[model samples]
Target: MTTTRPVLYLFGSAAPPVFDVAAVVADAQGRGFEVCLGLTSTAARWLEPRKAGLERLTGHPVRSAYKMPGEPDVWPKADVIAVAPATFNTVNAWALGITREFVVGVVAEGIGKGIPMVAMPCVNAAYAQHRQFERSIADLRGMGVRVLYGDGGFVPNLPGRGKPEEYPWHLLLGAVEEIRGAQGEGRSS
Candidate 1:
């Protein structure tokens, strides 16, 4: 029997790349993931104008709120969760286990469920230097979450100076692919 593509929960925070997330979504699907989108309320607005296109791409509703009572959840169970273009606020809130928004809620629950996750930050260099951001990265990494940053991952861009091409959208997908490969190998071994 043919297996279904693995579901990947693609979360986006309010950042520049969130405006052009379709490219990232296209990349993830190319690497064999079945993508589902969840955005921070703020980020959701950025995509709202093109919501129909995004929905068609993912075959799922882009969720940003709690589902109505007794409404069946439409999102698929994730084999992995990737948060791309994560902002400083989202990083800190997630590390502190705050679930005030749908994106953060998925993160908290994903960690609890032992689902592999990867995050790619899009903070400015100044914001990246914040004590909270540093601590959040450490705390998340300590929990086995792949916080993709630094040399091989996302490097903070200079304030108001970086181009959209500089965001390491692929690193987030690569991290997820690596984790999935590792998990598959584990099962076979």
Candidate 2:
């Protein structure tokens, strides 16, 4: 009904899987859905998306909220909002309705507008197990935010290596499927 494709809000630490991002985008676009992208501050550093490149890919302005003035938020017209490689900080902020930047603002807006939001928390076991972090995740779930977690999404036994290919394809695809199912696209051809 008034859904404008799907907007994916990507965030991470110093490094994230650009390949995963590309793969997800490719899959979604191939499925005949438009995609919009929002990058977190640190993510911008590793995967530098040219202004025009991002604009052309997402058909929406791509930016890191900190670098831009005012808050960048997802339009209410969006059908789905997904945070892939969701940082612990970002996840907690979203659950608390805190808006320190564009991505956070978009998450808060999604909550306020009752928009369906999905997140793939990409953090290590230690950080993820932290009491505050766990609580924040619980809070988000209570509010109807779908969270995709576990080792399938978290790579183990890898130290000091940051590669997009290291990220689990199955888990990422599963998250994508979750969003599709939520958007009523699961039954679509």
Candidate 3:
């Protein structure tokens, strides 16, 4: 099917990404994409739903997995799935095809249907450097997922780590662009 308006599924982990998510949402809206966001239970603590007024902004309701009752079977037929600030837990789950959570279930279904998945991981140096985490990324890639390279080896907002030139909007959207490109090439999930 020819999709005029690309559907984007935005997922944030319990620990929000270092970059701002509100800006990401605005950018996606400006780009003419339909946005639906899923916030991990843990992520909501760091992220304020009121800050973005996410439901109003995305034109779709926003809720955490626990708060949301039943599976969201009729998602917007996403052209791309962007999981930025993907926590170690979320990334691992996606890599393993585990659908225990809301975001995991959406991504699992998306990948199974040939949608491209983009994961932008944010974690402490220790976790990022762990062998298990590394293997999980490998497994995701093996499953045709794209793991975008972020500020590796540097902790966000920490002194001496320096800051990335592009803020949350760019980094997350850039990953989406990569997924869009892969999709145009008929890449599988």
TM-score versus the correct structure, for each prediction: 0.95, 0.75, 0.77
Residue 30's lDDT in candidate 2: 70
Candidate achieving the largest lDDT: 1
| Best of the candidates, TM-score | 1
lDDT of each: 0.87, 0.65, 0.70
Per-residue CA lDDT of model 3 for 1-189, tens digit only, reads: 234788888888865343366667888878777887887766665666463576677777675664446655444678888887787898888877777787888777777788877777766666776687888888887887777754532243443343333324465677687667766677454
For model 2, which pairs clash? none
TM-score for candidate 3: 0.77
Task: Tell me the spans in candidate 1 whose CA falls farther than 4 Å from its real position.
Answer: 1-3
Give stretches of model 2 more than 4 Å off.
1-15, 49-51, 66-76, 151-164, 185-189
Over 1-189, each residue of candidate 1 has an lDDT whose tens digit, in order, gives: 122998889999989888878988998899999999999999988888988999999888988887878988787688889998888999999999988988998898888899999998888999987898999999999987898889898888789977777677777888889988988898998
Candidates sorted by TM-score, best first:
1, 3, 2
lDDT of model 3, residue 30: 85
